[model samples]
Target: MSDVSARDAARDKARDRDGAMSMAGMSSERIESDENVWTRRLVTFLRVMAVISIMKGLYHWAQVTGFIGSEEEAFENQSMAWQTATVYFAVIELVAAVGLWLATPWGAVVWLTTVVSMAVIELMFPGIYGGSLTVVALEAVMLGAYLALAWMAARERPP
Candidate 1:
């Protein structure tokens, strides 16, 4: 082979080798730490949270509209308008989570905003049961989940 041909072949081989490890839907970034790997998995979980957040908002809206009742009595503590607002906010939160998982730049913004909302609400609201037995659980969990998604996504260098 000519020098140019040999050089081209070498570059192609290197690229192929780099690509091989990523085979079939795998990512090129190899996570070095176990915690970081789990953090990435949390991003996938956050993607699922996209659907859950929307559903949760709908459920609240349903309650306010009289289509459903709160599974927990604590919801009775909140007013109908408050419930409605919660529904609207939750839906927005869900949409943002989805956007983030999709790697839209706005996703990080949504995640940060919602997680702050979550932290604040969790501090304010006491559920039907004491000591963490409430929808506060969701606020708590999703707060971390959104943060994790944002963090991991930041680490991700898109292919």
Candidate 2:
């Protein structure tokens, strides 16, 4: 073979070898890290958070729709603003949950924003949204877990 043809053949072989271990059905920027424990843990954490987010969304939706309890029970005689906020939270949270489940960058960002926003709303509105110390504590814990997993995944280069 000519020199140029031989070099092209060698390069193709190298690419094929590298591609063998690459993940399929994911973005090109994603990298498989099966050997990395941190990646595995991070994925698990994200999935767990996704489930929680979905459940939270559903709960809020039930409240807003008056399926779970009376309107008074859900809103606790809160103003229209608080009631509207509840509906908004339900929709945004459900969307964010799906994004997080897909392991997309936007999902993480949305989930983080949703959690923080909920915490703030609860704190500011207090009894209007059935805010409680327990809810705040749980949010803090989940937020910490998400941040730690994100940092680990970034460091490990998860697939």
Candidate 3:
């Protein structure tokens, strides 16, 4: 090969070794940026939320099983339907918590459903379920966070 062609080939090889080709149009200096930090923080926050959901589910299970509170205290004066619904809540919460821990889309969907179901039940039967504004607030905040993360993730593009 001509000397000029060989020089060009060597330069191409050096550029490839430096990740110039693999990075598409991105510069090596711009490869690692604030986006990475935000992505990491978002993932960490989601995982922490998952852990909280798991703990909340376990707490509900404990309440339902009379481990933390007496069965009579938990179901006292509540109708049979409310008691049954409590059991359902415990089961769904635990399952959704597991899904959230796995970071799957279905996990978020199920968790939102569980939250909405609980909110609706509490609202519709304030007496039977003993509704609390705190539940609504917590669920709203969590849902907001989930939605924001999803929006941000979707907006993210190669830079």
Candidate 4:
């Protein structure tokens, strides 16, 4: 072959070899790490919490719209405190749910705030939600789980 053709063939072979090496490097880099596993678990937990938040928000909205109560217990007929709480929760819970679903930092903050607020209300102002200890306990457990998962995921990250 001519010198020019020989040079071109050598360059093509080099490029092919480099391409194969890069592909192999990419596959090796894809090996699952502890951080990746923990992050995925955290994401899944957040998604589940988001669904629960959505349901809670919808429930509050139903209450406010008189869709889940008797005529006498309608939103207009409820005490001012109940009306205010229902509306506040109806809006905030849904917002928090969206944030959580997105798996963003702000979403976790918002969700935590919502959980703590509900727990406090249930404990300190029993009249609002009729003081369900069960609800408070559940919220505490969920909060603990979230914190644990977040801690694990963060710890697994490379410094």
Q: Each candidate's TM vs. the true structure?
A: 0.49, 0.70, 0.72, 0.81
Cα lDDT of model 3 by residue, 1-159, tens digit: 699999999998998877856676675464556655555655666677778777877876776777786656765545787777777877888788777777777877788888788788777777756888788778888888878877676667564
For this target, which candidate reaches the highest lDDT against the unseen true structure? Answer: 4
Number of the candidate with higher lDDT, 3 or 4: 4
Worst 10 residues of 2 by lDDT: 21-30
lDDT of each: 0.63, 0.81, 0.75, 0.91
TM-score of 3: 0.72
lDDT of 4: 0.91
Candidate 4 steric clashes: 0
Q: What lDDT score goes with residue 36 in model 2? A: 70
Candidate 2: count of backbone clashes, pairs at least 3 residues apart or interchain: 1
Candidate 3 regions exceeding 4 Å error are 1-42, 74-77, 157-159
- For candidate 4, write residues 20-81 as lDDT tens digits: 98898888566655547888999999999999999999999999888898999889988887
Ranking by TM-score: 4, 3, 2, 1
* Residue-by-residue lDDT tens digits, candidate 1, 100-155: 66856577577657656655555565331222536556666767766666667557
Best by TM-score: 4
Per residue, candidate 2 scores C-alpha lDDT tens digits across 1-159 of: 699999999999989877875545444776655667777787788888889889989988888777887656766565787788888889988998898888888998898888888788788877566778788788999999878877876787635
Off by over 4 Å in 1: 1-43, 70-81, 125-138, 145-159
Candidate 1 lDDT (Cα, 0 to 1): 0.63
